[model samples]
Target: MAMVFADPEMLDRLAKSLDSKAGAIPQLKSRASALDAGDHVSGLPAIASWLGDTAKDLRRRANILRSPSESPFDSLAAFGLPPGVAGDPDAGKKFQTELKAILEAQKNGTPQQRAQAVKDYFATLSPAQQAALAATDPLLVGNLDGVPVNVRYAANRITIQTEYTKEAAYLATLKPTDGAYKRTQERVDTLRSFLNPRIKSYEDPKTGQDMKIEVSRQFLVFDPHFGSTADAKSSPFPDGRIAEVVGDLENADNVAFRVPGITNRLDNFNGFTNGGYQLAADPNGNERPDSAVVSWLGYDTPELGDSVDPAKAFAGGAALNAFRQGISVNLKPNAGLDIFAHSYGTLVTSKALQAGLTNVDNVTFMGSPGLGPNINSVADFKMPNTKFFAMRAPGDWVSYTQGHGKDPADFKDITRLGTDGASGHSQYYDPSTGSLANMRRIFYGGDAKPLTFTHTSLDDEQIGAAEAREMVGFLHSKVPPEIVVKMGGDLDAAVQAHFAGRTGVKDLLLEVHSVLGKYNMLDRVPPDEMFGKINDLAGNVAYKQTYKAVKDKGAPDFVAAAAGKAAELASEKLLGAVTWPVVKLLEVDRIANDAKQFGEIIDRGTAEIGGHVRELGTELGREGAQIYNDTKELSEGLFKDGGKVVLELGDTVIRPWNAGQNAADIWKIGDDAKDKIFAKVPDIAGGLNDVKNTVVDKGGDIARSAAETGGKALDKGIDIGKGVVKFFGG
Candidate 1:
């Protein structure tokens, strides 16, 4: 037994390494960006192209060892329960007669029908007998795919809970230093995941606003995923928690199953689920989208350094078994199904399809490393009627990680769709991109228009000014499915009226004050209105503060400090020139994007606002970041109290926040790298993130087309096969 835990520090390091690698890949041999030259793609000579490819390959090879995943199983004890454990020792003996009878009856039907017949057989058993089996032999009933959802949920609860109880009791008898403690802790961790799955909150990549969704731990595969072997200690990590679902799998007419890449865990499943929720959500107008999604982190995921290992995919067959079973049991006859994957996940997905993932209509890959070694093209997937689709963001670096196999985008056998959000390898699901829309159209019938340019021009190649606007708009839309879906409507009139006053006697606030005004939005609104607005915004933020003193203060000192400063910026002579246009530009935006721009314009178009403009910009960027952190701590906790459904504009609390904030800071610094090392990081790092409308993300713009028709639960494996995982929604 082992106490398996993902070291947060190690994970953070891995993300940083990959992020650096992502930056280096696009920057290979040149200080200028790839899109800087209009002739880089189509105008290039054949030799130059080959050199570029060769150079990229060399770069990937050099960095290939950058992040190999560490599997705890390698250092832990061998598989199988410890001595004297009773894991239904009588399971086989007791099931022999019933199994034989059921098989005899199941012999005549098609695989699908035979599976259903087994469900029928279980249904025929008296409730008491079924309960007895669930109590003593749940592995048999709970694991079989063809079993009814109700039966599976019931049996799994018993099997999982009973195993947990037994393990817990045993754990109590052992010392903390016991050899069994670690493994038991690992076991208990897996079991507890099933019992108390996590909630993932993220800023929607497409919209750039915070969203929340719960990752439901549906199935619990507690045994060894690699099966019996002489090198048992080196076997793949046993599949553990958890998996999340979106949509109604048992009742939905269409479903999709998603296999994840690196850094996936039961704890982080919500990030993907959030993408699915957005993907399946009803478009702004008349259509009601009906679909389901399942995000599966069902296997021991390969992390940083070991991400390219074949075992990860080779062992994916068991994860496939779970998905196949999910499809087998809950699927309505003739309903549609699709399989989706990304990066290393493509290996798992392809291997599963090649092995025998029947009835899946399409197998798709986004930012794929490649298909596994044996599989070469769409032709390699043997499932009848299965079409293959591929999408790749223009700058994504995963195309270089070929140890897993060849870039699927190069295969002529498959249909290719251009990516909207593929600014980075993992950004395919961003709502700002067309990638998610493309995939949704591919998986669900829809009309989507993905960007088809092949690097000839860099207009939409990376997240740019337009992308930022869309992201901001996505956040502030304040409408259904845009970041935080709220038809919550306008702020209360009474509340609005109460805080409607302007400040005239404000003091002289300088550099940092000017910057903080924009962060707290002091510079955006009317100079006279800055104080009242800041105080009101602070009051709203204060509502969520957990500390009684801060709560009593209404808006911590930060609010008053921010407000007081903004009031002073109104009359400050140095900034007086550009203040109006800056306010106008920012009034419509949430994030403080134009602080630096206005500062430059102030110098160029008006007076010398002095060298401190950059200083003020950096301070704005830094304060913006801190304000985000402070409020997120409050906003995230406020959900339980029903105070605020989601925080307002300029909230950068997601993983990508650092990148966003850094980008802002970089914009301010403009080339002033001598000042602070932290402020210079984004200029050195890669794109914001590998964030896609990930899981069933909305990136392809795939989801946008085809007249777009329609649109969770731990209860029934939480809609596992729907391929819809959660994103925040009411």
Candidate 2:
């Protein structure tokens, strides 16, 4: 019933303070009832709200203070009937009379007087009336009527009591526990064996331990509709195909399982003709003696390159769903599993993970065409601790030309796949060579050393190597040597330097030409043609230029005479060369000073020539003897200690490379034109000899005089620059 608050201001303040706008009207009524009954201070609106409708919802939900036999509020917020109404409108007069009685108790009374008045009013009701009143007003049955008129003022009269049930109360209750569930599972497993039987176990010949054991609940070859096999007695799935695989898994632990792609077989519950176990076998029937492998032919699909039927989609999902359901139910606490999915099997693995069915440690995709369009985040897949790895070999046709929708990383975002230059489609199992080492790192985890391939095939050793490499990756091993060599400091610098020097070789050839011509050795070519040949040869030295030889366009007699003067120039140059022969003297001094250095230079140069010969893929012919004789004659002459004849031979053979380049360009000009170029080599060396001996024999007097004169002339040139600057004074 609505109990109006006597103080409007107090009601307003209590409503604002509690932030309970919905409960404000009811709270005001509760405050008025308490004050009218002389049970609380009317002035304390905040405290009244706590004991009013605001608290009603809280108390109903707790049900702590409710009598065991009475109904609590319908909802936490339910309270008494509205103000101005009771059980019926005709009873308003009766409600008013009752209200006045409660209001009259607060005035002119002791604490005991008010308390007794409240108790006597409640005591007036008969047991039947009390029962009816209790249903409508639960607070009345709990002695709430006689809360002391001065209860807020009396510490001694106020009483509080509580009751608690003992351990026996909750002990009778029920909930599930791990122990019971596991025990129940044990019973179910025992019962399953009666229906399904062990089909086979792959044993290791060396260790004699069953690596992968298979079992089927039924041995029936079901129809495409999953109906009974023609031979009911010999079906693969006795209880069910999925159930038998679940039994095998529950019994053993494995590092990884290979799920093979499509192969047609009917009535074999697991699609026997093409399955995981069959695919893992060495194609040539060679056993992988080093490791255990299983080709999982569990996936259902049409043969490779065959179009998919709409009806089979549901079957595919169902088969995967069955395996997932079984694995989830029987997951061992400590064991982790790896799955190798090749080709169409990748699709199955992808679905299983996406559906949250399989709990796998790592998943590898080999020879995969596609997974899905987008698998960007970890949340996109269903399993935990799952690693997605794939490999494509160099010779794999698919790798060479399969259309990539975008850049590899972007394609990964779109297709949810990953590929590296080293990891793209290729051989994943042939350890003899190729990407198997890299795949091994992704799977088994191990170190990769020098791997040599004799034949291209993905065999057991290669598979073992790839798995081992994957194992090493798991262990965080060091990278391979080839990677180190390509990326490291010393080798990188050497490669750069070697290439740069090669580019400069042609320039050095041109520099030798200028030095030869400075000694009046212009007989190297007919004067008119020398300039044209220089430009022609320079073109051939680099791709930026194309060399074209000038034909014999009828040379003038003067040009022919210049070309024919080679012998005269060689003789005249020899007179000067003989007077100053320090090049010959120094050669003698070096050969006498150190025989070991001489031997090493000769050995190293020969080795360098040998390597170049091998690279050109050439063979020595009859002309080889001429080259050997030229080399021996030159070496013997240069090796001598101070002989004029040897010195002369050494100079002719060691002509400037630039002059030789010019000579080569013009050698086809004519017979006399070629001889003049050959004759210029000795002319240049003989001229240097004339000057060397002139200074040597005279105790360096002539050289000293010339140096002093040159210094004076250079000083005079500096004075001239200063004079010119002053003459133009600003």
User: Which predicted model would earn the best lDDT?
Assistant: 1
After superposition, the stretches of candidate 1 with alpha carbons farther than 4 Å from their true spots are 1-114, 126-132, 162-193, 196-237, 241-244, 262-289, 297-307, 315-326, 356-358, 373-376, 379-384, 429-433, 447-730
Instruction: Kindly report the root-mean-square deviation of model 2 from the true structure over all alpha carbons.
Output: 43.6
lDDT, candidate 1, 11-33, per-residue tens: 44555554555545434435344
Task: Give a tens-digit lDDT track for model 2, residues 355-401.
Answer: 55455666666565344435443445644556655454433433222
lDDT of 2 at 523: 23
List CA RMSD, all candidates: 39.2, 43.6
Candidate 2 TM-score to native: 0.25
Instruction: Give per-candidate clash totals.
Output: 75, 62
